[model samples]
Target: MKQDQKPSVVLITGGSSGIGKSIGTFLAAKGFTVYGTSRNPSKFENFEPFPLLQLDVADTYSIEAAVAIIEKQHGRLDILINNAGAGIMGAVEEVPNDEILKNFTTNYFGPIEVTKAVLPLMRKQKQGLIINITSIAGYMGLPYRGIYSASKAALEITTEAWRMELKPFNIEMTNVAPGDFATNIAAGRYHAPVRKGSPYATSYQNILSLIDNHVDDGNDPQEMAKAVYKIIQTKKPKIHYKVGQFMQKFSIVLKRILPDKVYERLLMNHYKIK
Candidate 1:
């Protein structure tokens, strides 16, 4: 963690695809000892792969075991990227309560659980960076993305508390807030609130149509990975890094500048949702 010494052991969660995979590919190419985790790494094929550790961030036991393996092999961890998350889309009222809780557990609590397991070592070493892959949802509200927004919003709060607490120990917390990224999020999402007789059923179809368009315009994961690497090497990494289209930055700025009603209307108008 010293200015002259660099930490080479990097461990990333959800490194099988999208942003996580891109970060792994980029960092490994830069000579970092990359240890990426996948719930099902077998899905990766024909690609230059990083040394993988089996971890499902949603499972604390899996996270612990992966960290143990990393510690035993590498002796120290220089970076921790909390990139494991799921896209759960639906209105809060329509989504099954259990599904909402489960999504929150995976998207919000999972990162904290993994971080808790790794922090003792990071603090003891007094020099490590923790990067969280949050979304623009953390800053702006959107229709039908209630669960996803709430989850990232929770992390945004956690990051703030953690930033102050960890900085004193020479560890830093950086949140990556990306906008529409070219990923299979919408395509890969699992909906637990699909009920034909449910009142929100018709609205759900409309939401899905909107999401299809959003996914069509997402950013490349590699671009996000490169940004993360820069954050790692930079001397002063901020508390948050925003990626994606200019709208991503514009949204954040508007959130800061606009009144509550104005922002809410803008959000509704942006998605053409009531």
Candidate 2:
């Protein structure tokens, strides 16, 4: 390796657009060998300056292949950001079993599988950082976006466990809990089996409007990317970091101290359900 060369390599999933793309681009500009992934890479090749790998986080074979490509090409992976995830919005009872499974497959299990695939390389290197992009909702379940919250919450718990377990290997893990950002994430939200005359229709519609407005007026994806860049540079990064609007990020702390009913009312008020 050259004396002044950028030797670090980073692999980010779901990096075709939005938050993932922003992080990949930001890190690449800083001289890291960044590889962004999507289920389809050629579609985004012209749009992005850096390399984009074809990866479907939900598929085991695709994940294994993507990691193999990165390891074979770079010979080392310094960072792995599990930023591939999607949201699902539907009443708990109304959401079909398969729909819930699909949501978890993408949001929860995908990261786990990707991390498992990359651990060997990081382990061989004996030092690496794995940052999972959970959500502010992971700390507290949202009104209509319950499954999204649940999946993120599951990821959060798993991250904590992995962090402790990976310490001996010098493999670090962190959870980045982001609030609604100005991205195309809403377009990918799964609103499955939502019936017109369902009892939760009014609440769902109202909550959806609130969610849209929040995201429309939210922070940029670059903000998240910058925060993550700092995390990458930190020598002792914290186990969890929250990024988003002030209130959204603060809500996590509030949930811990506030009474259950009080917190419930605050959530209802925020969603304008009452």
Candidate 3:
């Protein structure tokens, strides 16, 4: 951000609200040129700080068109924030296959496709950064959130491989896994119905309430925005970064050091599952 230098251009997918919106506003305030994307841009007509572009990560043509517009306007794209995602909650035994696939389409494949669309621009620029917003849940399989966990975990691992491949090009890639944030993710997340007399009905209902409350009391989205800003300023960013509350972030470390069954017991106990 020197006097002679142009502000870096950043594109954040799913930018209309929640964490994406916060990040865009934060970066814009810091003098970075920011553009946020939504599946339907017209709905966010009054969005401030940065303009919203119409981009559905799940649609290849939409992804390409959005990137094309940015390239035309800015001439160079410096950062891509893969933040668009959806959540799914259900028992592995009960969640429909199509629902699982749909979740993956939004949370896993969507980000990957968007990254693919942006890579050529980054490569041509010979310098760029791609930050994939993963989740702390991705580190382990939570009972009702298995699909959501798997989708994020997939992105986390994929980013590791992508980082190595992009090394020679001076382009960088990384994953930032966030824990529960006070976002509207719960409202948007797909939930398999708690069928009457189903074996998991009681426990599933209990955990569902727990999950919503956790999100309701989660950290501010600005915390994530600051973390992203820090990563962008890093000369050689790490393959992975995590942002969340103390115990939430520590949960990953516990999983690494604790016995498998012991960790499972701890998780079940916290969820009040038998």
Write down the TM-score of every candidate.
Answer: 0.93, 0.96, 0.98
Best by lDDT, which number? Answer: 3
Give the range of the ten consecutive residues with the poorest summed lDDT in model 1: 1-10
Indicate the TM-score of model 2: 0.96
Scored against the true structure, residue 263 in model 3 reaches a CA lDDT of 99
- Candidate 3 segments exceeding 4 Å error: 1-4
Segments in model 2 whose C-alpha atoms lie over 4 Å from true places: 1-5
| Alpha carbon deviation, residue 176, candidate 1 (Å) | 0.7
User: What's the residue-level lDDT of 138 in candidate 2?
Assistant: 90
Pairs of colliding residues, candidate 3: none
Q: Candidate 3 on 1-274: residue-level lDDT in tens? A: 1111899999999999999999999999999999999999899777777999999987999999999999999888999999999989999999999999999999999999999999998889888889999999999999999999999999999998988999899889999999999999998999999999999999999999999999999999999999999998888899899999999899999999999999999999999999
**RMSD to truth, every model:** 2.0, 2.1, 1.4
Count of residue pairs whose backbone atoms collide, per candidate: 4, 0, 0
Candidate that beats the other on TM-score, 1 or 3, i.e. the better one: 3
What is the C-alpha lDDT profile of model 1 across 1-274, one tens digit per residue?
Answer: 2233544888999887778888998988987889888887776655466877788877888999999998888678888999988888877787888888888887889999999999998888777889998998878677788778889989988998988998888888889988888877775676756687977777677778877787787778888988988888886679888898897778889889989999999877766667
